[model samples]
Target: MQAGAGQTPARRSRRRSPVPFLIAWIVIIMMGTAGAWLYSEHMKQQITAQIEAQTARQIAAMENNYEQRIKELDAGYSSQIAKLQSEVDSLNELLTFTKDNASNKTDNSNKLYTQLSQVQKQLDELKRKLDMLK
Candidate 1:
């Protein structure tokens, strides 16, 4: 095309360089990566919280079971103690009865001795009469 008489030649439009486009694309990708990383971290925190809650529940259940077992054991121990006390009382009574019986035997021994002495004297007299008759 011929230039107009007073007008300068038409200048070509400046083409955009690739560097700015590349920089914009890189910024977009960086923003996307950062967003993805943030989402991943948030999900990890949620999972950790859920696990902690489950662990706490399990620990509470274990504590309850342990407490119940301890209570049962204490009840058994108390009953055993009561039974042992009763047995000890019964043994004490038996020991007291034997002690009283021993004292009664001592009083009866003197009478038994006197009866034996009189029986020996009568046996001697009978022996002399038998000899004279022969």
Candidate 2:
């Protein structure tokens, strides 16, 4: 057969339907979007958990610092109070000693006054005797 005469000319190639390719593309795009959304959600959860853990650690550190500061303040106050009490006790002892000395001085002054009066009366009677004889 002549190469092109006995055969019916090859029918023009049938056009392939575009619908299956379009459907395949749509499915691929949907899967890619879902994958991206899932990845974003996972990253958000990880970030949130890290932030929470960091905040908890900072709060615990602050609390410990505060407690240590309070302890130091308490120790300082207790030391000051003890020092003040010691001073008060010393002053009280000094006051007691001064009071005892003041009372003793009062008693000695009274005795000296009584002796001076008796001596003065005796001298006056001696002068009267001498005048009568003259």
**Candidate 1 structure lDDT:** 0.67
Instruction: For each candidate in the order shown, give its overall lDDT on alpha carbons.
Output: 0.67, 0.67
Question: Which candidate achieves the best TM-score against the true structure?
Answer: 1
**Alpha-carbon error at 16 in model 2, in Å?**
2.4
How well is each residue in 1-134 modelled by candidate 2, as lDDT tens digits? 33564555565457999999999999999999999999999999999999999999999999999878767766665565555555545555554565567766755545544554454455455445434433
TM-score, every prediction: 0.62, 0.55
Which residue pairs collide, candidate 1?
none
Model 2 global lDDT (CA atoms, 0 to 1): 0.67
TM-score attained by model 1 = 0.62
Which pairs of residues collide in candidate 2?
none
